[model samples]
Target: MLSLTRLNRVRSMDAVNDTMIVEAGDTLLQAREQARAEGRVFPLQIGSQGSCQIGGNPSTNAGGTTVVRYGNMRDLVLGVEVVLPDGDVWDGLRALRKDNTGYDLKHLFIGGEGTLGIVTAAVLKLFPKPRSVTTAFLGFRSPDSALAFFTLLRQRVGQDVAAFELISSTALDLVLAHLATARSPLSLRAPWYVLVELASSRTPEDLENDFHEVMQEGLEDGSILDAAVAAAEAHAMAFWRIREEISDAQTRAGGSVRCDISVPLSKIPAFIEEACASVLKIAPDSRMVIYGHVGDGNVHFNPLRPVFESAADYLQRTSTAITTSVDAIAMAMNGSISAEHGVGVAKRDELLHVKSRVELEMAWRLKQAFDPKNLMNPGKFLPRLECVEALKS
Candidate 1:
């Protein structure tokens, strides 16, 4: 594997264009720091930001917590310098906001999962750093109520709503049980929770006031069961920690089968209801640990093994059934099975089944055009035609 860690560097920061040129090997954390130093912000805020490289972000089209406001990696990236399969460098790094060129070739590699080419560097768009941020953790009676609260929040706050996440009660319970420092911000327990964050260039008082108003209204209207507003930055971080640490907590709790899926915003409640029911029908004793970026309609629907069952036994028995059932429901609801997570070896078969024949054909054609030898990141995202044929035989 070619290591680009040595290529890590922030080439330039042009405040006038609100753009920065960063080498692909630079970690997301480094990019964020450079942007901060330049009085700007790189809004791709993922849990693995500390170690995840910038090149991989666009290659996978990563959608982090701030995706609702800033969009995924494709939206944040303006241009990329890719090393083609032929060993030629394509330097298309232009920071212009408008380029009415013949074809926007940069997109061919962004979200391409490295099959098209190797991205060595990129021109990334930046935004003004939010001067103030307000966070609120609200307990809801159900996912329906949480959805209602989200709609109300967006209607009231509009673009100020930076992140709106959904958390299941079981997911929170696991966090509290596993993590030493984990604590529920709300006094009362409910079936579901929504972590609401508002960030803007406005004053702190303005942001806080908006949060209080919307949260109070949600509570009065019965959409919210109970709520906790962060009084300080520490408080906000604590609330976010519960959401961020769920995956780690799940690992500590037991064996987990995770589904990264997304449906229409209107279908979230129904999708969750049906998915949970389907999983329980297969594994009665399984614990459903569900949570995700609800604002962007992606949910990490994970099922944990029963306390009595061993990890190996549980995975062997329930893994395929659980994933298939959830993925089927998501497809029936016109949602995607892969969502933000890229289709690696694990999801290759699932991708083939879920994606249309036309879509798959086009993807294969593009892959052949870019890397005819199939030498670039082979057997990663798209399955090889020969492998599929061999499996059939």
Candidate 2:
């Protein structure tokens, strides 16, 4: 994961009525938390909340830490001020919900990953603070068990299941070994552990008890091997720290080619099985660390070199093969190669491999319409193509 970019001048508008304009340099966390301080909450957050800029979030259409309920950053944004490729401003900054006055031009730049323009400022939507919250840490005997547990919990909690993160034993081991204060939430070893959080809009509903009751049923049905519910606010923070630290722990372990992908919810169990098998078939000695937001059907499938192999050489040799195999499996299953992580430079070619020629042409036309000079964050999303006449010239 790319670390947060440092902001030179983070600024926010002091407007009233649940609306505010945040400068490009401001981090999503900074903007949202500041909005909350003014008695409103920005309904958007990304994984690198501490450093990831608002410009990047809206550019990549980041769906982060609370995507299950709040949706992506795209959903939270009302309007954006963008500088076009040729240095002209397109001021489409109206905070209206239903603006059919003309073509919806803002959609082009939202998920363009900055290829269309540089997002200068944005008017973000804010929601009322959640009344009550509950978070639980759960352990499962296997990946399938975790998937089953997700299904049961979603049915019970409905959309209140804000986040359901899966963590591997290898992943957890790194946290315990590398991070000094990290502690295991469960006493026994299991193939996978899940961190779940529930937030409610109402007061009378006890989401903690509701969550505990569901986990109890899961244990009785042999789905959950063990569980630990956060007793206090500090404990809830402790449980979340584990999930948040997984990426860092993984980095310290060894050389890894991390893939963030999504498949159908029903096929998650099968996708993991087949994808890992295919990887091992090619690179038999590779160590696989599988974990992700199972409830959202996204996985961070990371492959690391075995302890005996030279990490640099391992990555050099198997990098292409790993990507090819995994992407092929993703296509066969009607899944996505780049899920939450947008196709920056890493997977642009892979995207072309899966997308149709007509689809690519349509995208190119849209890009041309918005960014004629193509000077805005070039070489990020689609491959550049010259017009037939321009090529002749």
> lDDT by residue for model 1 over 46-106, one digit each (tens)?
8999999998999999998988888999999999999999999999999987999789999
Model 2 C-alpha lDDT per residue in residues 313-392, reported as the tens digit of each score: 88898888888888788778889898888988888866556887667778888778877777666777885464322333
lDDT of 1 at 318: 95
Total backbone collisions for each predicted model: 0, 0
Query: Candidates' lDDT values, in order?
Result: 0.90, 0.78
Pairs clashing within candidate 2:
none
In model 1, the clashing pairs are none
State the local distance difference test value for candidate 1.
0.90
Candidate 2, which segments miss by more than 4 Å at Cα? Answer: 1-17, 386-393
Model 1 scores a TM of 0.97
